[model samples]
Target chain A: MESIRLFCPATVANISCGFDVLGLCLDTIGDEMTITKTAQKGIQITRITGADLPLDVTQNVAGIAAQAFLEQLGTDQGFAIEIHKKIKAGSGIGSSAASAAGAVFGLNALCGNPFTNKELISFAMKGEALASGCEHADNVAPALLGGFTLIRGYEPLDVIALPVPSELYVTVIHPQIALKTAEMRAVLAPEIPLKNAIAQWGNLGGFIAGLYTEDYNLMQRSLSDKIVEPVRSPFIPGFDKIKETALQNGALGAGISGSGPSIFTLNKGIKTAKKVAFAIAENYTETGIPFEVYTSPINKSGVRIINR
Target chain B: MESIRLFCPATVANISCGFDVLGLCLDTIGDEMTITKTAQKGIQITRITGADLPLDVTQNVAGIAAQAFLEQLGTDQGFAIEIHKKIKAGSGIGSSAASAAGAVFGLNALCGNPFTNKELISFAMKGEALASGCEHADNVAPALLGGFTLIRGYEPLDVIALPVPSELYVTVIHPQIALKTAEMRAVLAPEIPLKNAIAQWGNLGGFIAGLYTEDYNLMQRSLSDKIVEPVRSPFIPGFDKIKETALQNGALGAGISGSGPSIFTLNKGIKTAKKVAFAIAENYTETGIPFEVYTSPINKSGVRIINR
Candidate 1:
């Protein structure tokens, strides 16, 4: 194929309790990138839209990922990419991952799909390293593989696609404020109490089981995070109240999405999800800062080729 | 029913990396307790065997567990328990759990199983607390429910039975050295580095997912304790050599079973399990501390009544 257009869905990383290891893909919002083969001997960003992301291939996440993918294939075949990003950068809903994973996913398709999904993830991780100071795939893995993902280890790139309950829907609220990932990480304590870590280990084990067994009560019980939420929630305005309201309105669990400035709650049904959305939105009433509430069923399919 | 005989199999608490949260039952090694009803109305120990254990109803694990069970039933009827225990105390093979869980299992059956499995676990935990000075169900959960189990939380009693791969075999070497669980627990650092905790959390989340998804490689990769094994292994003679030899001989993963003096290795099949057993046994030749190797399939059926 001379050209390919891919839709890489937005994702929520950390899922409230699992810091740096857990993430889930979303269906309603994402980024679209189109890569076309050109006579030029290097990757180039032809156009960038919907967000003021860098146009330079070296600075752009999509470009950096595409560059890595093409270089890994040892190809001098030049490509031009046009990015129409629906998911804003610095939104904390894996914005950079959508761009990075999309670039790799799109370019690999244009280059005859040479790399495995695991290899593609490696290419995208480089982009994340460029965007953030650290190379992480909590967002990138789920963005590339879809549904719920566990980045078991970053050293050898162990990405696991966990089972997703069919009845679950994701309710997300992205506040207007921009919170950098690095800044969000800086707010965390250098070490946590042993008791808190033990609690997290238990919740992580139970939550994964709940997904496989489809036990809602177990899932709900497991959603309360002991380590990260209490520390990071204060950074996001009205985070505590919003999460409290969402759960009170029937959310399975609620927490700050990714780095924050965005909040997400999981619900069992659409009716409950809608109610959660309204309740979460009502929390930002005094700030006068605009926020968008999105309701999506767990995106069963992650990134996809839309046009060729 | 006036009398009931039950077998509560030995279990591996922590199951490699998940301290205080994960455990598994074994088919070959455990404890057997027999309970008989008496009109005199109090719990009593009629006989004990396999290891010297206290006979006082309040002092013995089996007896303490039985007292709790009988008291919960509001029964004036007394019971006599014969502890033909196979799992050794201070062996780190859930010896206490077997004694405790066995007592309750026999009594519950004698009383028509008034409590659900969850309730039985709560009652059994009391026995473990009395024996070990801590209220933990990592061993008791599996000893009662069988197969692979996750103690999601000790508070409010969340015990979940996870799936076990059919081909998985457990090969355990119990060194005949007495290691007190409380002393072993005391050696652990009160707090761990956050980096280590993050790594543990990732391993734990992946380990549970691997169980539900039946991914053997993921499960194997996850079975290393970054927190407990390194700190406590020095207390167990020849621990590192046994574990190293087991892995070298084709064991998937090896670690301290619960507290130490015993080490367990998991393998994919009986053939490899046998090889691991031999390798582990050979390691103890220098120390000359007596050790026993028991190999069996994952005990899917935990505690069972042989006669009613």
Candidate 2:
């Protein structure tokens, strides 16, 4: 093959009650990576796009993923990686995950689909750990495989594919402020209350059940997080107002995307999607935060190449 | 109304991983309670069969619920409660809840439907709290109103009626041994490992999703509980064998019912239900434990007046 162009969709990890366990891939917004093979011994410089991404191979997420991929495969063959970042960084939208997943997925195909999707997810999560200082597969797995995904256990990475209903629409809003992943992690308490923990599990159970059964009401009721969202929402301006407005408009539930700065609402359909997007946009306008709105259907298909 | 006779179905409270949150009402087997207005100053109970039940108005399970009902309504007209027990006590099958729910439901109708179902459930749970020392609404809610139920929160007691798929079949095996609720609670550690907690939540999510969507595979995968089951399974004889046999005989999932001695299996159809029941019986027979099996569907209508 001459070259392969791969797109890895943005994901909302933890997904309200599903902290570090559940996630879903959103269509229409993500990062793209182009991989090309060469007979040379060393990896070549990569083209970078969207919001002035780092060109240094060590600092660039896509480059690190490519290096990790080659190191894991014990391959000396040179490869050229081009990163076209469509999803904004520091937006709580799995921007780094998209690049890592895209690179791993792209390189896997470029090197002859050597690993399973689960393996690629694990490999890409290393890049996430490098970026975020902690390894979590919720974003990486969903970005790679799509749909409703669960990472039950990390070692050997038990990735279970949860059924995603067709009626679900995601409205994502990215405010112009950068929330560093490390800082986000720092603000979160290491230990959560036992009561909150129980309630969290209860909601998570209902949420997963909603995913499998497509019970919209249960999904709505279960899409609540007392642990992370309560602490993280205050950091984002108009987070509470935007979520309330989105829900009032038509969204079933809304919460901070991944960590913070980016907020997302899970809505009923295309109309609700539009309404939710408008609601978030309205909040951002009032708050004087520059924002972009994305209304997309949940992409069940994760990291795959459009042009190979 | 001269008199009302209702069948209050058996229920599984705590639902393994769900613990005080989820419950399901059974169709085929339950306790029958009859309430009639009388010219007495307080409630009177007559337990015809089942366990050595209390008959004093203050001490009786049904009588306490009857008292709560009257107090909540600000009336002191006496009622005669006749409980025809079909679900035996110490069966891990909500025998007390059936009595409590039946008394509240049957008396509510006899008193011209004095309170809503939610209010009646709350009144009945006081009786359950008197019996078990905790205000658990799991069994009472489902016993009063059939189908899968969630007690999301219990300040005012937010009861969510979950969707029950038509294909779900329940096979319940009641071993002739008693597992006290207090002992069962004591058996579980106050604190669990964070990893196990995550797994429990994932499984709970999967189980709930299974209930709504009827995803058999997800249900099976998510049915494995590391926390409650491991800690409490040893209390029930032949739990391991019965669970294994039930799953082997085409059960989607199987676990100890409530506090234990009763084990139930979720199956797809009558065939699987019968097979599951037979498997449990066979496993128990080998262990020399006399067990009773009931194959039933999800009872959509709970606490019905079977006679008047």
Candidate 3:
């Protein structure tokens, strides 16, 4: 049987107010999954790529989603898998999502495209449950379908493609330090002050208004997170300085992406994008930490099929 | 000097999550103020027309605003004022704002128009402070400017006229019951749960996006209030039915206007506007409450000087 290849872009989840609801697909970063059908009636062990990939197909992110899919389909057909782990694992960039979404997307093609995009997203989210220890669709949705998306409702997985302004550019800076996702989750306060919550709503409203109106200035004024960032920023060194310098340099807004070690800045234009990338790089350079800077437009296209 | 007569439209303040920030100027209801300059040097508001007019000019809604405007101009010109109140007082339709804004607007014309529209709003807000026992620009800005206005910041009084969609029509039902603004303020929770706050923010964001994109469906889904409405709605008779009927009759969104008694619905077209009005009227009829319904488009032009 012929092998099928699937590409999944890196995603930025928990975009400010849209915690566990909004996610954006990136243009330059992600992981890849390739699946080749086999004559055997059961799944085979696979080789992992890039970082030390997870063994125990049942416990593995991709393997778990595939198992769920196979159980749902009641199919005995087996397949060999290969993962090109391009994105660093646990970089706060939807690393596990890339693997999960890629596998579902790759297998759908391998099985002659039995399910729809919506079905693939749910099956993929099952894998996220294994990775995060709970059901979460933030990363998988955008990894499967690009651009700015809103999981307005999740019981049936109501996904919406919201309007993204053309002037928007995202600059992600990943510090070389390792911050585990579970550790990042522990730092967040279970309860937030009421006044701060109202302020958050105000900013979130303005931010959404900014998206629809392309009001970059409103986005700049409204890009604040009192509930999450203040608590999480302490773990990431120079978080305040990076945010201030990025805004002062040219970025519209800056904040920690998902759980940190990675900081993201939103720029208004190409020129501002370059300046934001440079400023972020300089911040990491001054701190004596090697960092990766990503400059990409909001990838409107989420998942791409490179080969048939 | 010739008396300058101006009409300032009534407004709805704290449009859901935009508390202390959003207001919309409406037609068919307001205070008609006539201001005439005299040779006397001291600011004296000689007369007022509205019933139960406060005789103490220092604290009078229109009189204080007139005084504030003169003090800012470095001249105390005594002015005789008369306000024909078309909008009933304490109707949750910006009664005080109509008076305050009318005074500033009327005085600006009588004083040879020394202040800009923005300047008048600040003076009007001072009058709002005297009337409502607090300094707020939500009602004043829209009353002075005559449009959908956002009072972004108050120190300098940053007012922005939000772009109004063409197909929008407002159905206002004033149910002839008064809920004191202060009492309404008292009922709001001083401490809100973060989870509720996040839901409010998501709704607010979606609402703003709907306004900009003219996505009526999104706006409908996003107009819910988790904090204010639950407590305040119980004060108004038939509040739930009015909302349910209006939406069923074609309103995009409906909510308690300002404090209580007065409810407003947003509809897509004239047909829906009439339907919403009739539905609200039917609900009021069933409840044995005499109500007045005002059907108007989004009033982009706020204060108009007619027969100056």
Candidate 4:
């Protein structure tokens, strides 16, 4: 196929206890992108809609990701990308990741799948680094591999795709306040108490176990962040109350998604997820902050072909 | 049953990345004890054998655990516990845990099994506190519940029993050096780098996922310690060499077994486990320190009735 239309998923990172290592893809919330094979031997971002991002090949995440993929492939083949962003930038829900992952995913598909979905993560992370100021896989991984993904380490860029329970649903509330990744990171301390770290790892282990066993109660119990949430939550207005509201409305767990400003909740079923979404929206409305709520099942397929 | 004899399996706690929260039971290395119902009004230690230990109920771990269990049961009836210790105290294996878990397990069995194996963890922890100076359930949970166990948290005492792969085996080398838990803990800082904490939790999540999926290679990759091992390894002579030797000998992973002095390696099969045990023994023989090596399958049953 010379041209391919793709749907790239948004992802929620730092799921409670899984700070820099865990993430899950979202269905029904993403960006639409079209990539076409070009005779000119270079990558290009021809157009971007719904968000005012740079069009420069080096500046745009899609362009950066596409460049990374082609450079690694050592191919003279060029591609032009058009991104129709549905997930807003700086919303703390892997907005850049969708664009980055989509570029490589579509390019690999158009190139007769030169790379596996997992292989696309490193290329996507090059773009992610431009957005987050660091090459982290928490968002890009899930956005590429689908479902739950764990960034076990970075030296070798080890990423593992975890099982997704069929009934699991996610409700993300993106408060329209501008929470930059750097500003959110600045609030955190470089060191944490060993005791708190132990608790966090324990909860992380439990949460993974819960996913494998499909135990909702265990997931609820294990969904706690001892180190990051306490310090970062203060930056977001009514963060505690929003989390309490979600929990009260039947969310399995709630915590800061990626960084501050966006709060995500995981629920066992769509009914509870929608209830959590409504409750969080109604509660956060008092703050008079413009916010959009999206509820979707855990996306089983990260990036998919829309049309060709 | 008026009188019951029980065998309580030894356990390996920490398991590298799962510090303070994870453990697994062993099949062959354990302690044997007999508890008998008596007309007396409280718990008693009637006989002691195989090792020097206290006859007084309060001083003995078994007695302390029995007291906690009986007190919680609000029972006026009494029992006599005979100690036949096969597992050495201060061996870094779960010697105290075996006794404690065995006491509660045997008492619960005689008392019509009111408490589940999971419920007995708290009572067993009461005895564990006497040994570790803290109410940590890593060893006790596995000793009572068997297989692999994760102590998710302590506030409400959440203990989760994890699935054990059928081929998993453990090899433990007890270097006969006096290494105190307090000293081992002293080497560690109260705080750790947030980056290392993230790496630890990432490995922990991966390790749990590996356990559930029976992925040995994943388990091998995830069995790493970043925070505790660096500071504590120096206390154990030839730790690095021993670990390298284990890895070189095809062991899946190796680390300090609860605290120090005892080194443990996990292997995919009994053959590899025994091979690891023999290699560790030969390597440590050069240290001129007397050592004992035990290789066993992963014990699925924690404490079992040997006779009634």
Best by lDDT: 4
Ranking by TM-score: 4, 1, 3, 2
**Candidate 4 runs further than 4 Å off:** none
Candidate 3 lDDT over residue span A14-51, tens digit each: 66656655678888887777788988865554788797
**Candidate 4 RMSD to the correct structure:** 1.0
Between candidates 2 and 4, the one scoring higher on DockQ is 4
Specify the poorest-scoring 10-residue window by lDDT in model 3 chain A.
A151-160
What are the per-residue Cα lDDT tens digits for candidate 3 across B16-54? Answer: 655556678888777787777777775555666666777
Candidate 3 chain B superposition, TM-score: 0.94
Clashes of each: 4, 5, 2, 0
Ten consecutive residues with minimal summed lDDT in candidate 1 chain A?
A110-119
Of candidate 2 chain A, the 10-residue stretch with the lowest lDDT total is A188-197
- Deviation in angstroms for B48 in model 3? 3.1
Candidate 3 TM-score over all chains jointly = 0.87
Tens digits of per-residue lDDT for model 4, B87-202: 88888889999999999999999999998999999999999899889888989999998999999999899999899998999999988888888888888899999999999998
Model with the higher DockQ, candidate 1 or 2: 1
Candidate 1: residue A138 lDDT (0-100): 87
Candidate 3: residue pairs that collide: A146-A302, B146-B302
Give the clashing pairs for model 2: A205-B204, A205-B205, A209-B208, A209-B209, A213-B213
iRMSD in angstroms, per model = 1.0, 2.9, 2.8, 0.5
Candidate-wise lDDT, in order = 0.86, 0.81, 0.78, 0.92
* Model 3 whole-model lDDT (C-alpha atoms): 0.78
